[model samples]
Structures are given as structure tokens and as C-alpha cells.
Target: MPSIHKNIFTIAVVAFLFRLLMFFFVFEHSERTIRPDTPSYVRPAINMTEGHGFSGNEHPPFFPSAIRTPIYPVFIAFFYTVFERDVLIIAFVQIFIDTLTAVLIYIWGRRLFSESAARLGGLIYSLSVEQAVHAVFILTESLFTLFFLWAIIAVSCYREHCRLRWLVSGGILIGIAILIRPIALFFPLIGLLFIWMASPNMRWQFMRHGIIFLLIIAGIVVPWVIRNYLTLGLLKVSSISSYNLLFYNAASLSTDLHRISQAQARAAINDQVTKELTALGWKGDELHSAQLYTAWSRKILFSAPIRYVYIHLKNDINCFLPDVTDFLELIGATQGGKETLSVLNQHGLIAAVNHYFDDNIWLLWAVFPFIALLGVTYLGTILGISIQILQKHWDSLRLLFLPAAYLTLLPGAAATPRFRVPAMPYICLLAGIGIAKSIQCYKIRQQQRTPI
Candidate 1:
């Protein structure tokens, strides 16, 4: 095998083994593996297999799902249909997908940076606690991430080769990714902008390519929009965006305005929105419900636009920070997820940290190293981006930094470490370059200091 192939294979093996161990560790904690959103995906999969189409009958209203797109539930249905409805099989599949993503990260780094950087990028992603943690959960992150990487890789290939086929492939991959997670619906625009910025002289030619790229993405996404309109009477891709805007973003602002807990804010908003919707004679009407939420959230969001922006930016920062609680919870070190969130809402972030560590002191010690590793990784990413900026590596800047920046912002006030999973590969790629550059700098300094 070539050295690059051998190195990537090793990284993939390590990633697979690590995630396999995590699956075994957390599979027993059905709550942790299934999660709150797991049923939303799984039930639809079960329904699909039972010939009920994409409708979810979990709550007896038998509503067609407008919040979740079809890709992930369909992914789950495949496993349930072919292998019996064992969630373990689904988790195992996610583990394999995540491992493949790590390999792709290596390939991406090699295409964008150096071989050493590629190897380091693969290793970094393989050892990522967040990536591995999400793999064990029956969430869209793993599969979505796989498609997300493929999309960007295709775009990068298009940039290098100026091929229309690569643009079409990128559009298809990104469209599938959007179905898996609607957060990426605008990513095609980002890709188009990158292609334009990457090729300054051939602007007109690339413009044509960009249009074709976007048309293909629209071709993929518009059908879903049509389906949503026909079934749910909502003229959008998914209602999840509107739901997040109201429940998470606006509720967060409500917490600050009302001086109450997040749960209380959600309750308050729910009551107020419910009464308003009822008065409008749109109760249980999915389309108007979404429109009402957008209006309510916009009212609150615009009332304190600056405050909301601050909150959104703060959430973006949190997206980069290490969140070991999920890992701890999985291994039974922490008591439960709610306790920590409750403490945070009741007291503050510091109090929550103290509460978590005061009880799990030994586990804190165990988790410290991984936290440090994450810190180092972020530092390296910063340094690497700085290097790219100073060197005027626009392609590297666009490919590595733009998506991370976009994903970081797109989650808005809903940002969490979980939301950060899709950007892990890009972060690792930049970190690899940064770490490699730092080592080279150190070696040069060492030679300069030695006697000639």
C-alpha cells in the first residue's frame, strides 16, 4: 500500500475500534442512545416499513412529519427492514459511517494541504470525543456528516478540475445532506461563492458552472418543498427551522426578558403562542402554526436584536468548547442530562461546572486530558487559519474555514457541541496544518540556535 493509504487505513481502524467500544459502553443506556429525537426518526422509519409512508403515528394524531426530512428516517428504515429493528445495528452503521468520514477527512486534507497534515487530520478526527459520541447515538449527525464531507470534497474537486460533473456531484451530495439536516440548505450558496472567489479570472465560466450547481441542488430540494406543501400545506423544506426559531432562539431571549428558567420561558411562550394561534382560528394548523411561530419569534428577536445577536454569538463560541458531559453521561459518570441543565438554568454556568465536578471529581480528572487535547486542537486551528490568511491561500481559506464559519453561525442560539459535529473534519484539517506548521517553525528555530 502507498504510505498515504496505509496511514489512512490505520486512522480508520482506530476510529472504528474507538467508536465500537463507545457503542458497547452506551448501548445499555437506552435513553442515551435513543435520545429525545430518536423516536422522531425511528418511528417514521417503522411507519415507512409498515407501508404508512413518511407519517409518524407516535402521538396518535398520525401527522405527516414536517419537521424531519426523509433521508435519515429512510436510512433507519433500511436497517430495520433488512436487519430487524435493532437500534444496535443502526448505531453500528453510524459508527462505520463516522469512520469513513475520518478517512475522507484525510483525503480532504491531502487534496487541500500536506501529507503530514492529512495524517494528523485523520488522527485528530479519529480521536474526537464529540464525533465518537454522536456516532453511538441514533442521530442524523453521522450520516449527515458523511454526505456533508462528500459534498465539499466534490466542490473542491470541481475547483481543481473545473469539471461540470464535479459540480453536479457536489450539488447532489449537498442536497442529500440538506435532507438529512435542513441546516445545510444554504450551503450550496456558500459553495458557489467559494468557487467564484477561488477562480477570479474565469468568473464568467465559473458563473455558468455555479448556476448549474445551484439548479441541481434546487432540483433535489424543490421536490421536498413541494411535498411539504402538498402534505403539510407548508411552503418550505422543513418546519424544524421555524420550530427552532421559536422554541430555542426566542425562548432563550424570553428567559432573559422574563428573568426565568429556559423551561419556564418555553412554557410561557408555548402558552402565549397557543392562545394566539387559537384566537386566530389556526389551532393545530401546521402551516399557520409555523407562520405564527416565525412572527412571534421575529417580534421577540427584533425587539432585542442586539441582545439576540450577542446570545447567538455566545452560542457559536460554545459550539467550539469541549462538552464532556455527554461522554460522562454515556459512561454513567454523571447522573443524568437534566440535572446538569437544570443546575445551569437555576444557578449559572460556573455553578453547573462546580456541581458537575464536585460530585464527579475522579471523572473530571479522567476527562481533563481530552479537554486539553480539544483546547490544543482549537489553538492549532486558529494558528492554521492565520497561516492561510498570511500566505493568501484563498482556496484553503474557503474550503477549510468558510464551512466551519457558516455552520457555526447557522445554528444561531441553538448551537451546541452536537451542532458542531458536521464541521469537525474541516476543523481537524486546519488543526493538522497548524500543528505541522508549528513543528516546522520549532525545527527551524532549533537549527538556528545550534552551533554551525
Candidate 2:
């Protein structure tokens, strides 16, 4: 078989089989452990599809809510309108999207590095167990990852080709992604900074693309912001993130005290939260209450500056850990989380060299190697990005948008598996490059040692 054909076939088979396992078997856990966010999304989707409104009126007397954004629920409604809202069907759709993500990663790697690196990166992404597991959830990660990857690709294209179209498209996509999850609310600003910092020689080119990109982004987001303002008197797209701060700081406070349950602490805050919000002129609305809770969290945090430092340090490290369980809860794991852990244990190719090796009990099993690989690739991407920035490697600096996104989320509350998945494709690209470079070095030394 031809090399291109061979590579394509491998990618196809690997993507199909791995994701098929997730969609068919592994995803049973998702249905079994239905997450709280699932019903929230489903209720809004049903309302939209049935001509009610974007109001999350799961119950009869449901009113308009500015809490959840409409993009993801609207997407679900689109599918429900055509056929039905089956979890299995959603799994299949996500599997397909995830496969295409692998192909995009391959193309991105080819453009950024060598063709060999591209293939390796694509393969690594296809076989990434964490991502496969993530697809099982009826959440925002799969769709968010898709658009995020595409936007990065488009932005990278504009950098290479100097086309305003790619920049505009990237901006529009960012707008779409924000509608699903507000994580990218600040991404346009980050992107603009990246553009200006990217190429000192191409100031005119950067200015043209940057302005167009920002304008289109503003066009996409301003309407939602306006709607939020008019309806809730708040100039925000969604108020859901206020809870992240609330919960994170609440958990941090619990840990500092060392005897209270985070859950109990959170529950206990309700009466005090109501009091605080009422004092602050809050009219007992969900969004306003969340604002108060967030403020209350901040109050707690600032009051104990030393403890705040310790909590933030811990949160940052935990947020980046491999095969983490905090994310498992977001996906609604239940006991399958332990099963997932047991399944992830395994030794590496270095261990394989010792063919007679037995007693795997001494080795780190299941998810350890996957976690180790993730750590290495992520750290490599960080190192590679630092080099790119210092050397003014303009074309590649845009890739920093993803890890930056993850980093912003890190200091907030908790780290989960899904949080890390978005950054994996680019990290894999760098890892593949590192692996290829190592192989090249080893081969060169072997040639030098040849006795001619």
C-alpha cells in the first residue's frame, strides 16, 4: 500500500475501533451515571425544539432563564427535532466529530512539523483513552473541542497564508464556542495579543487580520451580551460560571478547616448567602444569588490570604494532573470511575524490552502510563511554545491559545479530565516532534559508530 493510503487507513481503523468501544460499551456508564448537567441541557433543548422558548421550563411554570446559554441546547434540539434525543445517537455523533478531530490534528502537525510527526501525532490522538472516555458524556466537551480545534486551525492558517477570511472565520467560531461555554469569553483578547506578539516584521498584516477578527468576534458576541443585559440587567453572556468560584472557594475553605465536608459547607452557606445578597440589594434571583455566592467566596478568600495562596497552589496542580477524578464527577462517573482507573494501568515499551518480565504487581498499571505520556506531551508543548515565543516563531505561537485557556480555568476551582483534553492535540503534535527528533539523534549516533 502507498504511504498516504496506509496512514489514512491506520487513522480510520484506530479512530473507528477505539471510539466504537466508547460508544457501544464504555458509554453505558454515562447513561448509568447521568450527570446533573445532562437534564439541564436536555430540558432547554426540549423547550427549544417544541416551540416553547430557550426557557429551561422542564417544569410547567418554568420561566425564562439567562443561566444557561442556547448554543449547545439548540444543537441538541436540532438533532431531537429530526429524530430523537438518544444518548447512543449523541455518542455516535461525538465519535464521528472526535475522529475528524484526529484528522485535523494530523494536518496541523504536518503544517507545523514533519509528515512523520503528523502521522505519529494523529495516531496518538486517535488512541488517547482519556478523550474516548470524554465522548461518552452528554456535555459540552466534545462539541467545544471540535470548534476550538477548528478555530485554532483557521487562525494558524491565517498566520501562514495572510488571509483575512481565516481570521474572520476563526473569530466567528470563537463566538459560537462561547455560546456553548463561556470559557472562551476572553479568548479574542488573547488571540489579538498573540497576533501582535507573533510577527514584528508583519505588523501591517497582523493589524489587518487582528482588527477584522476582533470586529467579527464582537459582532457575534455583542448580541448575546445585549440580550443578557436587557433580560437580567447584567452585561454577561452567562451567569453559570459564578458557581465555579462559589464551589471552588467553598471547597478550599473546607480543606483549610480540615474537619468539615465541602458539601456541608456549601449547604451551610445558603442562609448566609441569602442574607448577604439581600443586604446587597439582591432580589433573590438565581443569577444574583450566584453573584453573591461568588462574592462571598471571594470575601472568604481575601480574608485569609495565606490560606488562599495554599488553596490556589493546590488547585493549579490538581487541575493539571493526569487521569484525575474531579473531571470524572463532571462526566458523572459513579463507581465506573474506579473501573476506569483499574483499566488504565499498564507498563511502557521500555518495560516491553524485558520480555521475561512478569509480576506486573510492582508496576504502575492502568492509567499511569497514559497520565505520564500526557504530562510529558503537555510539558513538551510548554517548552516548545516557550522556544517559539522567545525565537519569535510567529506561525506557531497561536497554538498557545488552548493551554492558555486551560490555565485560566486552573486557578478558578477544580481540574477535570475534560479540561485537559482540549489541549491534547497540540501537545501531541509537539510530543510527536520530540519523539521524531529523539529517533533522528539515535540513528545519527548509530551511523557515526558504524565500522566502515
Candidate 3:
């Protein structure tokens, strides 16, 4: 085994080099194309700087023009203040964060498993095309993942030593991460449950710790609610409108449907669909320009809730499935998306080879089978560890399991590969233990077989 510092440094170098190569060579041309939410963030941050009250769409004051939390944009704006609003620089910063996340994954894995497993996990994560692609785009997923990983690290620290301050620190990180992305609100509560389940005899102690944890979380969140109230005159906690929109429009016609001008019946249906949302409480410039995106979403839900559920599930699955061809075109390896198939035909052999590899990267989903194998191994390790804890009656392991289970189960309903990435270190750690245990058993059997 290598020294811990050496292992970390090696992983960092490899991860950084991989990400830097992708940032410079691959996404160089693609970064200019504004991502889905880029304008929303840039415009609102510009508005905020201009001293305008938060007047973004269906979202609360917290998100403003951006559908995401404000922290990452604020960080981006700080860079813009210094370096000018070069999308390249912003993209580079995101790449750096993505690399940092890889480092964190390695460190967390090392603690949970062994150095080799940590290195492997970090390398796989660093080279992941999905992570690399997303990193180049200006979006919340990369930044949100950084904070999410930090929260997990904080939880691991708290598990190692029962310190109130560590618990509070973990709570605050979870709080900020949730603010960044509302779905994270489940973390601290999950942590608390893990703690309680781990500590049966220390019930009173756990309760006190939980109370302090909640207070720390509330301290961070309550002020944001206050700001939202002052700005919007609404008593909402965080941004509820986005969720409403997602819930409502989870099954609407594709935004591209408007392009088919010859289909008068389809166009009429689209117009009626547009009007249906405005007829609801959806108002304001954002809704008007965006055509009551959330309101329209809600209308879809109201019309057929069950159908919407099915559609969202299908979409989530599709998000995970390999779309190598589309992704290749997205990264400019193919001439498919912008040009007709006839035009692509004119490009000849070299271009065809590029297109073939680009379009087929979705085959990487094949890795999911290996990941699932690791997951099963991790489960067995967890069970074995749980048995040990039960025999020893170790409360800390029990506490750790609570948060671990929460993080695992919460995302199962909407499982995308990226969504699953944040949990990879934990999974890898468990898998590493399983591997280590098998080796130990093998060595023991060989020792028993030796005859004099």
C-alpha cells in the first residue's frame, strides 16, 4: 500500500489531467452553446447585481432567473467580476470542481475501503463521459454534486467520532446543499435517523444531538424563507414552483413539437395546451415568455396524474440508458443533429468512424452491470458489518447506516447514472470491503490446508 498522501496526490493528478484534457480538447467548441438553464442564471444574477428585487419565474427569490440555487451562480459571478464573463473560464472552473469531486470520492473511499479501491473509484469517476460532458456545461449538477460529496464526508467524520460540532458542521453542509438543490433537504433528517438507530441506549443523547442538528439546519434555512417572504410576499420555504412544474408537465408534448407548421391540428392542440396553463394561476413575464412552463406542467398533471407519473418514470430511465449516437453528435463527433443524414453521408470515411464511436458511447451503460455487482457485494459487506455491530452493540455503525440507507433509498425512485454518482464512493467502499474479506477467507483456507 502507498502512503495516504501519495495515494491522494496520485489520484488528484490523474483526475485533473483527464478532466483538463476533456475541457481543452473535447468541449472547446461546445461550451459556447448555452445550456438549458444558462441564460436563466446569467440574467437573474445580472438582475440581482442591478439591485432589482428577485423577480424570476415560478421559483422563489432564492433561484431567481435560474432554476437552480443561487450559490454557484454567485461563485461564477465572482469569477466574472475578475476574469470577465468568459464561458470558457466558467467551464474550466466547473471542470476543476468535477476533479475536486473525484478527489473527495477517492478520500472517502480510502477511509471506507482500501487505497486500491479508492484509486479505482476515483479514476472511473474522473473518466466518466457523462460527468465530463456535464462538467463542460454551465449547470447546477456539477456544483451540487461537490456540496453533496462534502456532506457525505462530513457524515463520515461524525460517524468516526461522536462530536456535536462535527454533527453541526455536517448539518450545515447538508443545509447549504439542499439550498443549492431542494432535493437534498432529506439528508440531515436521514443522518439523524441513522444516528438514532445506531444509538438505542443513548436515546436521550441522540435526541439532544438531533435537536442541535435541526437547530443548525433551521438557522441556515429560516433566513432564506424570510428573504423569500420579503421579496415575493409568499410564505414558501424554498422554491416550490419548479417541483410543481416538473409534476405538472412531466408528460407534455416535446418543446420541438411547435416546429411542425404543416400539422394544423397538432398546432391547434399545442395552442390549446398553451392557453390551458395561462388560464390557471400562472402569470408574469417569465411564464408568458416561457408559456407558463410550470402552469402547463400542472395542467398536464391535472389532466392525467397517473399518465404523468408513468411518463416521468420512463424519462428518468431514458436519461440513464445509453444514447451514444445522440451524445456523439452533441460533442461534435458526428454530423447528425444539425445536418441531414444526406449531408453526413457526404463527409466520407474518417467522419463516419467518428460518428460510429460517438453515437455508440451509450454502450457504457454496460458498466452498470459491474456497478450492480459491486452494489450487491456492498450490501453483503453492510450486512456482515451490521452483524458485528449487533454483537458488539456498537451504536456508531448503526447511526452511520441510518444516513447511508436514507441516501441510498431516496434516489432509487429517480435513478439516473449521474444521480447515482454521488453515492459511488460509499458503494465502492462497501465493495472494497467485500473484496478484502474474500481474500482474507481465501488466505485462511490455504493456511488450514497446509500439512506437515
Q: Number of the top candidate by TM-score?
A: 1
Per-residue lDDT of model 2, residues 234-317, tens digit only: 677887767766665655565456555455556666667766777878754766876676777777777777876665655554
Worst 10 residues of 2 by lDDT: 337-346
Ranking by TM-score: 1, 2, 3
lDDT, candidate 3, 1-452, per-residue tens: 55877767776777677667656654558553355457756655555554553434334544433244566657667776678667777778888788888888778777755666566656666655556666766666678778877876776676667777888887788778777666677677767776666546876887888888889888987777667656544444544444435422332322223322213423454576556655864444332424344555565456666654554454343233332333354456543333222122235435543555457545446445544554554465575465446556344344334444544444322333445444444444444444555566789999999995
lDDT of 1: 0.86
TM-score to native of every candidate shown? 0.95, 0.83, 0.70
Candidate 1 lDDT, 1-452, residue by residue in tens = 98987988899999999898898886676666876788888988998898777876765567787879999999999989999778889888889999999999998788788998888889999999999999988899999989998999999998899889998999999999999999998888888888888656999999998999999999999999999999988989898788899998998887777787778888889999999989999997778899999999999999999998877776566687677877887777776445554456457678877877776567777888879889889998999899999999977787888888888887766777888899989999999999999998999999999999
Candidate 2 stretches greater than 4 Å from native? 1-5, 26-30, 250-254, 257-261, 274-284, 304-310, 324-369, 372-398, 401-411
1 or 3: which has the higher lDDT? 1
Candidate 2 or 1, higher lDDT: 1
Clash list (residue pairs), candidate 1? none
Give candidates' CA RMSD values in order: 2.0, 6.3, 7.7
Candidate 3 residues lying further than 4 Å off, grouped into runs, are 30-33, 49-66, 237-273, 276-282, 285-330, 335-418, 428-452
Please give the lDDT score at residue 93 for candidate 1.
88
